[model samples]
Structures are given as C-alpha cells and as structure tokens.
Target: MKYLSSGTKYDSCNQSAICHAFGPDGRCIQLYKTLLTNYCSGECTYCPNRCERDVTRVSLSPDEITKITWSFYRKNAIEGLFLSSGVIGEPEITSQKQLEVATLLRQQGFKGYIHLRLMPGTPKYILDQIAEVANKFGVNAETTNKSNYSEICPNFDYQNDVLQRLHWTDRIIRKKRKEFRGTNRLVGANDTQFVVGAVNEPDSEIVNTVSEFMKKYSLRRPYFMSFDPVPDTPLSENRPSPLWREQRLYQVSYLLKEYGIKADDFDVVYDEHGFLSNSDPKLELAKANRDMFPVDINSASFSDLIRVPGIGPISADRILRSRPLFEEKELTRMGVVVGRARPFICINGKSQASLSDFLEACS
Candidate 1:
C-alpha cells in the first residue's frame, strides 16, 4: 500500500493542503488516495506499470484496502478514500475490486466521502452498484481525443472505454439527484484528467474539449497533468512539459469556469504554434482587448469586474455589495490585487494607471 500510494499523485483528484479533496459541501478533505493494485496488463506507452515495465507489482485485497481506509477515516487521518487500480486482468474485474472496497467501507459505517475510479468501459450495471456507495467517481480521459489516445496508449479505446464511461457517469449522477433530492453528491463532470503535452495537441484543443465536456456533460471542471517523462517508460527521453504550461491551462480553465471566458476569447492568448506564452492568461486577455479595461471600479458588473487581472469573484461581489469607492485603497480592502488591477480599472472615472505604463512593464 505504501508504494501504491505514491503512484496516485499522477491523478489530479489527489490534491492537497496535502491530499486536499473538496467535499460536496465545499469543504477541503484529505483523501486517502491509493492504488488497489499496481499490477497491470495494458501496454500504454506513458504508464510506469504498463505490463512491460520492470517494477515491483503489488495488490491489496478488497478487505485489506477497506481496513486501511476505515482506520484512516476513524482516526481523522483522512476524511475520504479515493480507490483506483491498474488493470490486473480485465478492466471489469479490476473495477469490481474497487467497488468491493467501497462496499466494505459503507458497511463499516464509513459515512465520509468515497471517490472510486471507474475503469474505462465499465458497464452501466457496475456503475449503478458503485454509485450506491460512492459519493463521487472519475474516469481519466488521459488526452483530448481518440487520435491522441492512440499515440500514447494504443490499446486503450478512447470511445468505448473512456468517453462512453464519462457519458454514463454523468447520466447516473443526474438520475440519482432526481431520485433522491438534495443528495447530489457529485462534483465535476464526474471529473477527469488529461496528460497535457503528452501529445502535440494544441492548448486550444485541450481547453476546447474541456469546455465542450462542461456544456455537454455538466463537467464542473477538469484537472491537467503536465507531461513529465518517466524513466524506463517509452517517453523517458521526451522533453518534460514546463510547469508554467500546466499553470496556464489551469488559469484559462478557471476563467472558463468562473468568469465565463470562452474559447474565442483566448485566440490572442496563443502564439503561431497555438500554445499559451508563459504568462498570466488573465492579464494577456486584458492586454489584447484594451477597450474592455479601465472598467469603472464601482460600476462594473460582477462579470466585468472579475475580468480584471487581479479581481476575482470574491472581490467582484464585494465591490458590488459595497459600492461607490472613494479611494484606491478601498479596492485592496475588498480583496482586489491592486498592483495587477491598477492598469485595468478606474475609480470615479479616473484611470488608476495609464495602460501604456502596464504595457511597458510587460515588455
């Protein structure tokens, strides 16, 4: 279990203030994310344990995982369990092992959040059983589309295995919400991850796919894994994706989610190669659309206020609720990042700082 736990860091669902998983109630949780087994049969080029890799293989029985999860939850060491696994044999067989662990936890009176991984192409019947005990679930798409999956994981089917399962998970979550009102324990479009820079696909395609998923499947958001070559795997020598690229994608995605920034809005954010420059995406967007900046700090709507580089939803709403600002320092009190927002906003129709000054700094 110790070694298996280390491998799960690849999945974005395992985040932190140290394993920080946010519950349905908007509380951050420490999820006991660990692999059910590290043994595998798939031959994916990027995986460390893709059947052919020489690594120590281990499997924890369903009963064993249940004990581990329960012990953690009881002691407040963790608030949840996120059970994922490598394909020990068939995908379905491995999925069953995950379900059994959740079942045992539920039976043990584990009321905390339980996030189980749904293997690609898991049949609807299995989804139903898993949903009964699971508060949330995920299926990593790994990449943007079928063609991309072919390059990195030739044996993995992006459609039947990955996308179809995503479609099903969305439906089940919706159905359960109707059957049991106020019981929608789901978050995300059931959530997914993509290995950014895994292929030569543009950031446009990645963000576009996530936007489409959000619209079509009610995806709350997506997590990105900046590609880092693993030793002894097929991609070991490939250049690792810069951490800034991952950070840029997250900012762009956040804009898409919170500020309703659309794909077309990002056209200038990319270069000739269709990649974002290593810079603040929000500032880039404001710079490109100069007319939109210098928005009246006091009168700007919640939507327009958040469009400013340093002003977020929280500060935007604060500005809205407490209006008619008399001084610039008031902006700071409401949580606005005054330094960044300086060039993009005005108070009492007075520009905070000339836009030319900001542009000069960027150069």
Candidate 2:
C-alpha cells in the first residue's frame, strides 16, 4: 500500500488530495488513493519508476485491489478509489489491467466512486469498458506540447498518444451522457494534467495551451503538478519547480475557466522570458492596462468588472444586482476586496484614486 501510493503521488490527482476540494455526494471523502502497480516500462527521465531507474517494484492484482478497497470501505476508512498506475508495458495493456481492477470492484457490489486514469495511448474501446465503472477519467498531457516530450519523455508521441486519448475521453463521456440524458444519470467527467517546469516552457505557453484545451475540448479542469526532481532519475540534479509556480498555473486556469478571460489578456503579465512574475496575475494585468481602470461601478459590464484586481464573478454579480448607486462601501459590502479594487473603480462617476494615491498607498 505504501509503495504503490507513493509511486502514484507524482500523478498529482488533485495535488494528491492536498489543496483541492471535492464535494459532490461526499464521494471523495476519504478516497482510497493508490496505484495498481509500481513496475513500469516507459523510460521517462523524471520518474523514479522509469525503465532506467533502480527501485523496489510491486504490483497488486485486480482481486487484491478490490479486496483492499472493500476492507477499507467496510471499516469506514474510505468512501472511494482514485487509482492510477505506472505504465506496465504498452498503454492499452496497462489500462486493461486497471479496467480489470475496477471491473472486479464493481462485481463485488461496491458502488462507490472510482476514478481511473488512462495511460496516454489507451484506445477508445478499452476506455469505453472502463467508463462503465469509473465516474471520472483523465489522461495526463504531461507538458505543454509535443516539443517538450523530446526533453524529458522522448518515448511518448504527444499528439497521437496523449492529446488524442484526451479527445477520445471527452467524446466518449459526452456521447455517454447524451445517451443517458433523460435518465437523470450523468456518469462521467474528464480532466487533464501537466507537470509544471519540466520542459522549461513559459507560463504563457501553458496558459495558451490550457486555454485551447478548455475551449476546444471542453476540458473539465487542468491539473498542474509541480515537478520535484526525484533522486536517481536523469533530471535528479535539476532544481525542483517551486510550488508557487504550480499555484500560479492554477490561478491562471481558473481565470480562463470561470472568469472567461482570454489567453491574450495574460500576454502583458508575462516577463521577458514569457513567465508570470511571482505575484497576483489579475492584479498584474489590471496594472499593466492602467487606462482601462477607474471603471464606473454603475455602468460597467460583467466582463469589465471581473477584469479588476479584487472583484470576482460573485462580487461582480452582486454589484450588478445592487447597482445605480454611489459609495465605495457598497462595493465592499458586496464582497469586493475594497483595498485592491478601490484604485481601479469609480462610484457614480467619482473616480476613487489617482496615480499618487495608488503610489502613496503602496508606499
């Protein structure tokens, strides 16, 4: 249990459940997170279980995984399973093994939430089989694009293997939901993940790729796993990507998904290297586009309001509903962080702050 769980942590399924929230039907409450096996054949340079690395390897059978899950479930120790794996051999073969695990668990009368991650090249047929039992499915894109695979994961054909499988998962899930539409039973959600800083790409590239994904593929979410160089891997001597970089990626993704912010809106926030600075991205964007500031509270559209530093969609909605007024306190009362938004917002045509006021407040 310990070895398998540790091996799968690098997958960062919900940052290994540390900094994410899961609240539907309490299905994720105490999930039994682990890998089907730690033995792997792929020679990815960053993984401890890569074919070139020397490490203790273990694999659990479908029956074993099913039994262990039920033992924990019966003891009230867990409510669901989040199972991923080290690629045992071919992608489809490894996925079939995991499908067997989920198949056995279901046959055992365990009707809990099961999240099975498909290997990058796993085909649609096997994906169809697995979706019968798993509620959520994901395939890790691993990095921004195919070019980066040459650096750390040369064996992967990023477009055909990773990107295509993601498309397949999305299509399959959508088709299944459509078939089940009138039954009030939507059973599948799909997500993709990336390893931050592994291939030396900028945040702009990451943001743009993720924006394309959310727009084109209807990606439910994008996961960013901070790349911590593992000892004995080829990249072991390289510095680990900071956790804050991973956090920034999440913030950018949220801005893309919920705020309806375009990827180009973030272009100005990037430094010369095309990376976001170690700061709030929204604030940086707002500061960079200073001319758009001092937006009228009463007349600004929802789109304009969310572009401000401290005003989020919720507060923006509240402001809209309670609008045609005067006073900064109303903004604060509606949930805007007054200190952050005050410099950029105007109430009833009364501009709140000047350049000196902003500079003085900072000083």
Candidate 3:
C-alpha cells in the first residue's frame, strides 16, 4: 500500500488498515500528509531538502491545496491535513506563507484536524496564529542537546531560533486555551528526527534533555524519528545509530515518565569508545550500584522501591499498599519478578544478599 506520496509502496498483505472520523457525516478523514514545498533554503547538514540539493522541488499553491483537500474530504478519503514545508526563505516569510495556507483552509470552512509543522525562527505572532488555526502544532528540535544541534543543524541556532519559537508557541497555545475556556486539552509540541551516530552523544543525554523539556514546558507527547542516513548528505558516510541504542533511549524515556527516575540518578557507563550497549540502562544501574537495591518492598520509600530491577511505578505502589498485610515471599509470588528484584530489594529488615555480595556477583 502507498504510505507516502513519494510513490513508495508497502506490502498491503502484511499490514492492517484503520480508519477514523471527521467533523460530520459524508466527510472523509485520512491523514493528508504532504509537503507545502520541497524547496528549502536552510542548509541543514542532514536534510535532503536543503537548498543546495539538486532535486525535483514542488510548491503547492493555496488554491491547489484547498481543491485537493476538498476533493479528498468529499470522497471521505481524508479527515484532516498534516502540512509541513521546507524553509523557502527566512523563517518569518516561510511562517507567514504557512499560516496563509491554514487561514485559507479555515476560511473555506475546512474543520477537520489540521496538523502544521512550524518553521523554526517563525515570529511569535505567526506561531500563535498557526496554533489557533491548526489542531496540532509541531516543531522539530531534532536534537535537544545544544552541541549536537549545532553540529547537525548548522544553519539554525537552538536557543535563538528553535527554543524561542517553541516557547512562544507554547505560551500562546496555553493562553488561548485559557481564554477560550478549553479543558486541560493542550496544544501540542512536536520534535523531529535526531541523527544518532552522526555525533558522539549518548542516549542518556538525549533522554535527559527530553525529560527536562517535558517537565518544564508541559509538552505533549514527544515523537522520536530514528536517524536514517541518506546517501547524499554530508554525514552519509557516518554510520547510522545502532537500532538498540534508539530503542533503549525510548525505553529509558518511558521509565523516566512512569517511574520518576531522573536521568542523573542513573549512571550509564560507556565502553572505551561510547554508549553502554550490554543491557538496559536502568538494569545496568541497579546491577552496578548494589547498595541501592534489593530494597525492602515492605519498608522502602517510594523512591527506593523504584530501584528494584523488575518493579516499576505501579508495582511499587502495590508493594506500598500491600506491605501492611502481605509477606515478602507472598508479594514476590504475585508476579513481582523478584529474581530481578532480589538482587536489589530487601524483605522486612533483611536483604536477600548483602549489597557488596550482590555487586560482586553481578560484576
């Protein structure tokens, strides 16, 4: 099946099809994903759409987009549009043009979900307007660490351009939600692809940066696009980030959200080169710092409870609630996976093994 507009097809037999609703009956509702224009002026080191690349570029006119959307809507082929564009000029001009497209859609009474990707360096007013018109507002911070950002996206400055734009849009969305008396429903935040192995940054740094952003900004869900090396980019010869590293980054991110572990609390060690790949970062932390675990599920603090290998936030909560009645062995039998936990957790006043002994065994 065709998943992208680039004439790329997938194996239809291997995939399942799904559907959703639009505003009213007779209206179609598929995600209308397309580029506003393929012509980008930004000289991002990793982007194939950079102005320096010699490729077929297309810019859909406002009228063209409107007509296409309407036809798709009438056929129940799409529910809303996800319109993104390359930086055709400076951010200000590009943002204005993007808003114009959304404005036209609104003026035409197209009320389906509109997801727009804001151009970096767009003025606050323009971003606010885009947020007002679109159902979701997305910005690509690709990498949150400033050093990696500077190296990969050389044309764009993180603090001056990207962060400022995100802050502005975030402020506007929150304010507008308040003014309109909308529920805790948030206007979202979107980040784009990170070039993993192109730079020597660790997964810990990436998770830390994202966690900080979520905490400080009340950001909506963050999307991670795995680094895929395109053949002609400046870093094409650089190896792609290992798949496990990307997966581990996401796993650690989930743990941060679910169990409240700070990135700093977990000490992830790299080999002589970089990035520890032998086991999950959290598991590695518990294994190395035996003093921290085989925590007494019956008596450990919420923070302490989380350090156990197999226990997550929910399991810790259960332990806290059930401890007054259940014995350590009973709790272990109830699917706590105490084999992992036994290495780091304690029962009543005693650990299954001494902290030093456990560390020595794991070592």
Q: Who wins the lDDT comparison? A: 1
RMSD of each: 4.2, 4.1, 6.6
Clashes of each: 3, 0, 14
lDDT tens digits, residue span 1-363, model 1: 887987786766643335444657453558888899999888888888788899999888888888888888778778788888888778889888888898988898887778887677677788888888887887888888899998898877998888888888999888877777765454323788889987889998888898988887777768898898888888888988998888899889899998998988898889998899999999999999998878998777888899998999999988998888977799898888988998888887788656576899899
Stretches of model 3 off by over 4 angstroms after superposition: 1-31, 62-80, 104-112, 144-147, 180-186, 189-193, 219-221, 268-274, 319-339, 346-363
Clashes by residue pair, model 2: none
Q: How do the predictions measure up, each by TM-score? A: 0.92, 0.90, 0.75
lDDT of every model, 2 decimals: 0.83, 0.82, 0.66
Candidate 3 lDDT score at position 221:
51
Clashing pairs in 1: 15-20, 16-20, 189-219
* Candidates, ranked, TM-score: 1, 2, 3
Query: On a 0 to 1 TM-score scale, where does candidate 2 land against the true structure?
Result: 0.90
| Poorly placed runs, candidate 2 (over 4 Å) | 14-30, 74-79, 182-186, 356-363
Whichever of 2 and 3 has more TM-score, that candidate is 2
- Choose the strongest candidate by TM-score: 1
Error of 1 at 170 (Å): 0.6
lDDT of 2: 0.82
Worst 10-residue stretch by lDDT in candidate 3?
7-16
lDDT of 1: 0.83
